[model samples]
Target chain A: MSTTDNTESLVQLHNAGLREQGRWRVRGISLRVRAGEIVTLIGPNGSGKSTTAKLALGLLTPSEGRAERRPGLRVGYVPQALAIDAAMPMSVDRFMRLSNRLDENTLVEALESTGVANLRHEPVTALSGGQYQRVLIARAIAREPDLLVLDEPVQGVDLPGEAALYQLIADIRRERGCGVLMISHDLHVVMAATDQVVCLNGHVCCHGAPRAVAEDPAYQALYGKLSPALAVYTHHHDHEHLPDGSVRQIDNNASPGCGHDHG
Target chain B: MDDFFVRALLAAGGIALVAAPLGCFIVWRRMAYFGDTLAHSSLLGVALSLAADVPLIPAVFTVSLAVALTLVVLQRREWVSTDALLGLLSHASLAIGLVVFALLERPSAYLAEMLLGDILTVSQRDIVLIFSVALAVAVVLLLAWRPLIAMTVNHDLAEAEGQNPVLAHVLLVVMMAAVIAVAIQIVGVLLITAMLIIPAVTARRFAARPETMVLFAVGFAVLATQVGLWGSLQWDTPSGPSIVVASLAVFLVSLAVSRGRHA
Candidate 1:
């Protein structure tokens, strides 16, 4: 939590909650995003990550809390699933011009930045998933919004593609200084790329930097049981330690029979 | 041109012009069933109009608006899937309208006209009414085009852009209600939805962009209306169903052409 400066965040939610069908979908959630920051919400299935993002976007009003935006702040959003029909018949260029009109130069630049400029005239549904996602990102970035909200942006991308997309997003932030809030289920690659992590399961479980949350029992319970094969950010953890903070390599003073640390 | 043909042309042309733009969004949003439900509810509007001795257009618009609003509200509940909710509304409203038809004593043609349509028998007042509503729907759609497209692309994304999806939805459904109101005179409740969906679907085959799709849909609808009217004169068939059949033929041809290209 980077001592959230109220005036800097383009959008913020305060103790927000959404109640539907007499049940709380998510509750008591608070978030703040400032310029050039990337906030990623991560959790397992039905973890309220999307719900929280929606609340912050004011797509779902809170039954208990409030979501606020700086007046006249422009934001661009990439939703979890667009769900547009295949029959809608939209070209990538047309989709980019939906909310805001862009000059040819800007349009080409945005599409080029995302590496999809060649696809501007193609039907949107004809594009592959990776291309489709890149188009969506380019559309959002083209508008020069103050904040960009992306929900589960890398759902259908391969591992390398996901990394490349994250890199592209980081470039956008560096170039435009737009705040970003995105949702994802991936634990490793996302943790390394994002500045803040909000782990949620019905409610916020833990939120902070990736390194701090690695050893968190709540986060570990949710993700640690899985093998390290999925971990993209490797750190040196060859040495084990007890909960009491003692190095567990065979203490030669006490474990002579053990082959451990037998200098 | 004969006055009768001229009036039919004006009414049908007006409806086609308006339907093209709205239908594009409907197809984009995959709201065919939703459109059907709204069309079915127009019967309730007509029934209410006759039962209450209220004016036809306002009553129809009101009831359709009511149904659209109800759908929007129910969607928020999430207890019922959108498809299921539309199913319930479609059949229920149809049944209720049929009941109204049975109980009320209007001209024998009234029921048939409401169920199918009677563009050939439209009066000057009806023509004026049709054009007025069509113009309104077109204007509203033009004004809301940006927000509507954004919402159709992704609801949360629109909200994150500081747009209210509910507001966009309300505007869209209201425009739909207007089209339904105007179209009920030319195509009746049963075929009203066809007018809203068919042209757009047919245009999908060749249109590479959304706006081009809208333009193509309008052109197709105009051509379908002319062919259907001419066919009706040649074969002494119902003008409205003939129009629908013409559009269906176009859709079939589009399918074949697109399939051949893909193959």
Candidate 2:
């Protein structure tokens, strides 16, 4: 809690809860994201991961406690899934400019950064699953937001693509120095890059450093045997595959170390 | 062309130009049924206009807007599924309109004219009204274009990125209500949604960007109006139905062309 001083905190939730239709979707949730930090939310379905994300993004006001954002904070978000109807013809280039008007250089740079520059003019409907996810991320970062919130950033991708995506997210944090809040169900893949993991089952079951949460009994009960696998994934990945098919060694000193407190 | 035909063409063209962009969002959001609901409610607007002896356009706009807002509120409640709620409102309004028409002792021919619009009977004043509303709608759409597209792509993404998706949604609904109110004179309650949907879907085959799709939709809609009006004059057919049929023909041809390209 005392970590709130030095770094600029982007969004903070204090015992925040959302009530819908006489039911508390999530309750007693406390979370924070600071500049250049990554916080991931891991939970099963109907556990209010999305609702919690919404509250943090100020999309939904908490019915009980409070959610606050830095004044004039610019945000970039990638939702869990975006099914662009075939009836709405949209190209990757246009989709990137959906919320803001970016100059040609900024647009191309964002696409290039995500390694989807080749697909800039391609129809969004024609993209492969991995390609679409990259384009979504590219679109979000093009705004150069103060905070980036991604909901299940790798929903339908293959295993290799999921790891690559997590790596890409980590790289984005390194480059942009923006705060990141991610929601993921893939604990094994997401835990590698996540600094903090809040495990939720209708509420915050356990939350701490990824390794700490992975060993928590509550997290083990919720995720069962998956926690051990997550521990191994978090412990062993000293390197990651970049989007350009290049392998990059993780610099423990510079990069957000795998579940280790930089403090 | 006779004066009446000119007025009809001008009015229909204005409505088409505005409706096409809104229709793209409708198609993207898969709100064809929502459009149908609003169109159906326009019948009740007609009834109210008749009952109160007030101006038709404002009455229709008011009723449609009210119905749209009610739908928004009801959706938040989640007591009933969205499709069921749509069906309930759609049929309820239509039945009420019919009953009210009967209670007023209006002739069946008048009711028939309302159901199957008499575009050739549009007055100069009606043309003025249509253009005014169309201009207003065009301005709002231009201003709201990015947010609307962003929301359609993903509502949560739009909201999290500091864009006002709810405001964008409300603005879109209001514009739709305005278009439906003005369009009721040309296409009537029964066929108004056709003007909003057919051209947008047709435009989907060729467009590679959202803006291109909107442009293509406008072109298709205007072309349909012209072709439909000409065909009606040549064959003594119902003008509104002729326009819808023309748009349907365009859509079918686009489908064939797109299928052939893929093959």
| TM-score, one value per model | 0.84, 0.88
C-alpha lDDT of residue B46 in model 2: 94
The CA lDDT at B49 in model 1 is 88
lDDT per model vs. reference: 0.78, 0.83
Q: Report per-candidate DockQ.
A: 0.61, 0.73
Q: Per-residue lDDT tens digits of candidate 2, residues A1-263?
A: 11233678899999999998889999999888988888989887888999999999888899999999999999998877678778777788888888888999999988987778999889888999888888888888889988999988776677876777788888888887888999987555775676677889889988766656655778767766546665455434422312222212222322343333322
Cα lDDT tens digits for candidate 1, A126-238: 88888888888888889888888888787777778788888988888878778999898765566545666677878877766544444456766666544344332222331
DockQ of 2: 0.73
Model 1: per-residue Cα lDDT at residue A4: 38
- Candidate 1 residues lying further than 4 Å off, grouped into runs, are A1-7, A22-24, A191-193, A225-263, B105-109, B252-263
Which lDDT tens digits does candidate 2 get at residues B209-261?
A: 88888999999999999888878888988788989999999888889888999
